[model samples]
Target chain A: MKDRPLILVTNDDGITAPGLRALIEVMNELGDVFVVAPDSPQSGTGHAITSNATIYCTAITIDEGDQIEYSSSGTPVDCVKLAVNEILNRKPDICVSGINHGSNSSINVIYSGTMSAAVEAGIEGIPAIGFSLLDYDWEANFEATKKYVKKITQKVLDHGLPEGVVLNVNFPKLKEKDIKGIRICRQAKAYWEEDFDKRTNPNGKQYYWLSGKFVNKDKGQDTDEWALANGYVSLVPVMFDLTAHHAIQKLNSLGFNEK
Target chain B: MKDRPLILVTNDDGITAPGLRALIEVMNELGDVFVVAPDSPQSGTGHAITSNATIYCTAITIDEGDQIEYSSSGTPVDCVKLAVNEILNRKPDICVSGINHGSNSSINVIYSGTMSAAVEAGIEGIPAIGFSLLDYDWEANFEATKKYVKKITQKVLDHGLPEGVVLNVNFPKLKEKDIKGIRICRQAKAYWEEDFDKRTNPNGKQYYWLSGKFVNKDKGQDTDEWALANGYVSLVPVMFDLTAHHAIQKLNSLGFNEK
Candidate 1:
């Protein structure tokens, strides 16, 4: 018999997070799962990798699952890199990240450690997906989203993803019956309005804590924000290419070489 | 007279990097400049922001210039946030990051701390640009690229950039005479072939050091990779929108809700 598909699992909420455990439970039904994730929470880390410091990875047993788990002292992206390069015996058929406690929608994808792991895997030519829930609470209910997760994962394995793309799947925080359905949508044009809390340090020096309010400026009904707001799971096929193809012509008209 | 454009300058290279200095010099001629960058090098930080730890920021006078400079204990994105939310008296007219020590071309844009700062600025409704040199050296010459930098910065000031978009400008590492001018291009379909050096730690732990070779798969002459190869500066207008607009239709066909 052919071996079950090798599925690599990871998340930014750390290996011990409840969200990671939920993801593991879902993936176990699909394939031979190998998990490599950060030992501590790495939310908002984006695509950071450890360059200035040495990365430490260790094999660990997280639960009673058949899947093997490894914990690492690195960012979410680093975890994927280490897993694909050092831990995994062969290239995995798929890489799945998160089922995160918080949303990785719209601009959050750019700041998400969960999605970064998936994006990194996609860069390595592995089909990957990042899943998140709309609830930010640590005790958010994920049981309701498990069916959709399994369905999506199975479908991806049945028909592979396109090159240079990964899925950013965000589920609305509601009862399964309340979820209207899934909508494949564009990342909404949204941003965080930063508000740094300024204070004095013990040494009489000034310091600041980073804080922000999410602002969605785009009024488009076809955006991820709209889908999530209307009780639908949002799936955005995300690409790492940052080039703005539309603006290139305008830049050429600037006469960059004119003396 | 209208107030000088408040231009915020920053880089992934530490505050003392030659590239940052060159950027400051260029912005000095254009507007009121504020330098808020990392105290140490923050290369490849992507869009990371400090959350688990306290951020320490202090004002420091680097040289005899009218521009204000401050060093921060944060990543490139944090520097931009701190500058806009705390340090700067007003929202800067533009935010320019990195005349970087190395290129942030093609897929490197995703892992770039330089571009993250620019992306952060763009998210905040400030026109942004990230500048880089093809040569990855501490003392790479940037003198010849000054004129082009001025021209582009001026055009951006005059025309303004589209919302949620920023420029990723990469200069070819050649003398002005040999340079073929500039090309507006898309991010080349390129990636790093990860080569991790696995070793055992003194504590009997397995560790990995990240290393890679850049592999450009796209041969299109209209790509940033080709532009850099042909001795032309590449201007790729980058957007934070990670959504694959074309995939929406394909995903819609999946019937995700059909149980």
Candidate 2:
């Protein structure tokens, strides 16, 4: 008989988040689970790694389950590093992050701790997936996402993901039956327009809270934004190579190489 | 009379870093400069933005220069956002982040706060560039880099970067005369292998400090790593879009789309 696959789980919404709990339940049915995630919500933390600071990772039990879990006072990227190097006995067969509280579609992936965990895993040669719900509420239901999540995990374990790519899977806020099939998509061209809320503190000093409106101008039907907007689960294959290869020839032609 | 170009300067190595001061001196000759950077070092913070926390941006004078400066209690990405949304009278003509104390080439870009600032500015539709020297010393000689910096900045001003692209310029730790001409290149495939140092405190609790060894296996001569190795300044055009478009077709063929 084949031994159960070792599955690693994590998230940006902390260990106690319902989203994490829901993911834990689904992952428990799949393999021998090991979870190490943030001790507090680390949303919008991006690909940050803690430096020159001491990180604390302690074993914890949130609820009775088959998974052995630990919580770390570190960023999502930190958690993945800790998991791969120090926590587990061996590198896991697969790693999954989130069931994040909100969407990480389009341009959100750049500023996402949830996706950062998955990307960190991918860099370490692990096939990884990051899942998100379109709803922002902390108590948002993740029931509809479980079946799709299970399906995708099976497919990944069945045939490993392409090298240097990780999955950015986002589900629309719908019931299990109401959800449409998944669509393979590309990241939509989008940006946030920052609108700072400047206020005077008790000391009569000004401080600003960052707030922004998501502006998606890409109308392409093949984009993640369009897929999620209509009804399908959006799956974007993301890569970390930021090189704009197409511009290299153009740059060479500009003759900046000359003194 | 024609007005000078507005230049926004920032870094991940803190507001008072010598590299930043050197960059300020170079930028002063070209245009009016606004310097908004982290009050403390924010290296490796990536694209993180402050949320649900008050950020302080204070006006300050580091030295007698025409460049206006502010120190922010935020990450590099925050500095760029605040500069664009609240501080500036108009959008900056160009945003240049860092003559960083260390390299952000290859996989390091994913963990770099310096490049994050440039990426954030690029997201806001500003022409942006991030510069780094191979040297990590606090007092590294930036003298050799000044002329090349001037030349590149002039070229960028004369011929704008391609749409959705920004430059990542990394100089080798060589004398000015020894430096070979610039080479437009692609990012090399590389990753860090974490080597966390575990320690026990007086409280009998174990903690870790993150450290790592950079490993590069890609032998492409057209890569940034190769360019830097050959005593040449490597110029890589970077884009913020994370989509792996080529892998989308292969993913679609996997048949996960079917219910």
Candidate 3:
């Protein structure tokens, strides 16, 4: 028999999250699975690493499986770091984060702990993908995601991703048949319109709750937002290189170097 | 004074950091300045926002100046959100974040709260820039940065940045005369080789201190890494669009849509 691909599974929703459990089951069918995930929920952590503090990890078995699991008191990105540098004896063939309980589409990826974990794995030169369901409920059905996730993971292992790139796969909240297949799309231009709910505490100290409406102004059919809104699973090939290469010429034209 | 252009200033090192005070002093020369910064340091928070809890902001006077400052109990990105949505009476002509206490030259931008603040402002459709010095000390002399900061900020105010773009400027640790001007460069390919210091805590539990050595493998002379190493201030125009556009066609060819 051909050797199974060694797959590292992780999530930002903590180890016991149903989304992560669903991912683990899917990954188990495809490879030798090992999980190193955050011990607590770490949503919206972005690409934060544990720099200013110490991290602690402990082994746990959430299910009877061939997979070994370790839960860490760190952010999702830190989990990737610990897994690669401390836990894994050898580099895994692939890493998959999330099956996140909420959308990580469009501009949401910038604030996503799920995507950040995948980005960390990508930074370490591993083929990685972050999977998120559009549904936010903890009990959201993930059966529709398995087939698509497997196909994408298999394709990644088959073809390999471009340098500095990782797959950000987000599924619509729909039945398997209702999911109108996958769309390779660009990140949509969208932003959160923050509304701070200012309130006075019992001690008379004021505070504000961060709440927002996601505003998607781009009407481009080729955008992830368009795909997700139209019931298609969106797969945006995200890159870690944040440089605006086109702006270099414009900045150079400003005579910054002449000084 | 023809209504000195309104400028918003902020930093990840908190309101009291000398670096921010230096930036505020610089902005005061060219504009009517408003400051909204974290009450405590939020250095490596990345693009994190205060979604899980309430944020608090209080007005404070750090120095005698025409500029007004508010200290927020939130991440740098939260400061930007609150500033744009609640604090600023009008949309500032430009937003500037940080005279960050350390280099945000290459991959450091991914982990920087300073750059994240600027990026948050850029996302809100304001022209923005993040400035950093190579020195990590709180008392690092920032006199060398004032001229360049003014020049760059003026240039940005003169010619607005392209949509979705922001400036990430980093200075080498050197005297004003030792600085070799500025270079518009691309973000260098670099990463941290993490050295986790695993230790047994007093309670007999294992813990780790996150520390790392930055490794720059890219030899491109046009990279930010090269410019900084060569004593030149590096200016990398950063974009919030994380899409790997080049990979879209490759992904499409995989029959993702046909399935």
Candidate 4:
């Protein structure tokens, strides 16, 4: 393959995050890499873009690498948009985001900035993937995830993904040897049980911190949760289409127009 | 019915948008409304939350209505988080967002702050709906939409939505008489064809504005786009599960194994 694949790399963990550095290292081995990510940590900052304010992007050197890097004053989605629209001269063969510090399995995808970058690329007619690990530690080991990441990325490059679909890959935090291979799975039926910590501010006003414990109610062994818990890296092919097709038929039968 | 349903209302178009006002008026007839919305427009801001900066919120009197309003310095998702956690004493019976100025049909749901608010509430186990009009004008007619909004809201009050599912309701911008009826449909397979408008700043650097035309390639008549085009109010039951359950079997065949 004399024509090296062009890979656009980004992350929700900002440019300097250890997770991003790990991701960059992995992508460097695979293709002609280009890095465009937020200037600051943007965890939990889903698909946000800078609309009301002007965004500024600057080129910076991350290390002695052939890849071009830019730091942006925008969200993860913005970084993708900027890269595709302003930076990249041509559409990259594939767009890969994260190797994120935490998991974006199940419903967490809705609030994940890492996945949003990939989703944005998918929306733009590019094959994209978002990778995350179960551990939230800054020094979480990503060395173990490289082979699987490369395999999946190569597969995606070889066989283009279906339109509007992207892959969400989450790895369980374990030593490389302890990891049970990769399993393609569905997102688990799970939700956050919100426990708001309310406290009085020093000014005698009340404030609250949003906190929650994840509760996975679905017992399907074929789900991302099961895959991760069993030490398998989970790969869920996700689509941006949120429609419940089966429920539509049920709703149509409700005589919504009977009035 | 003196104990009116506790309805938490919000929007991506800011607390002062006409669309939010219309939603507030409709909810006022059904419940004791509590509005916690962003002080500024938060369009295109998916599920972002404020973590790096201290958020400021204050009770504000926008009009002479019994509905209580609070403006916050955060994203639409943050509004939901703040409202449910700090402002309201109890979980709302229903959380309604938008009456958005533009359509959140199809893949737009992924980038929509309007739908993100509803999805956020749904994640927290609240029955939620995000409403939008096909028109993108600030002064789009909400008169005809009110009837459908009320009808849908009433039905939701009567029949609770399924767990992990929310509704994305989009109304075709038509005259009251031109409107056909409401239809429950699946999300259309559509995407934005992004064409970045590149321009140079005074500093001689190039930047781009993200702009695009929406393209609906799906021929399915059972989609939200089709329903809206046929002069009907489209309601798509959306789920937070991003997993493609059907793909699991194919992945199982890949022969992944433990090291």
**TM value for model 3:** 0.98
Q: B1-259 in candidate 3: lDDT tens per residue? A: 4578989999999999989999999999999999999999888899998788889999998899889999999999999999999878789899999999999989899999999999999999999999999999988999999999999999999889988899999999999999999999999999998878999999999998888899999999999999999999999999989999998888888886544
Clash count, one per candidate: 1, 0, 0, 0
Between candidates 1 and 4, which one is better according to DockQ? 1
Against the unseen true structure, what C-alpha lDDT does each candidate score? 0.89, 0.93, 0.92, 0.86
- Model 3, residue A68: distance off in Å is 1.0
lDDT for B89 (candidate 4): 88
lDDT of 4 by residue, B1-259 (tens): 5488999999999999999999999999999999999999889998887755556678998988889999987789888988887778888999999999999998888789999999999988899999999988998889999998998998888787877789999999998899999888888888776666767899898666667788999899888999899898989999887776665665556444423
**After superposing candidate 4, which stretches have Cα over 4 Å from the reference?**
A197-207, B1-3, B203-205, B256-259
| Cα lDDT tens digits for candidate 1, A146-173 | 9999999988898788777899999999
Where is the poorest 10-residue window by lDDT in model 2 chain A? Answer: A1-10
Comparing 2 and 4 on TM-score, the stronger one: 2
Best by lDDT: 2
**Model 4, A11-81: lDDT tens per residue?**
99989887788778878888999999999889989888776566778899988877889998888998998
lDDT of 2 by residue, B1-259 (tens): 1488899999999999988998999999998899999999998999898985889999999999999999999899999999999999799989998999999899888899999999999989888989999998998989998998888987897788898999999999999999988999899999998999999989999889999899999999999999999999999999988999889999999999666
Docking class of 3: high
TM-score of candidate 1 to 2 decimals: 0.97
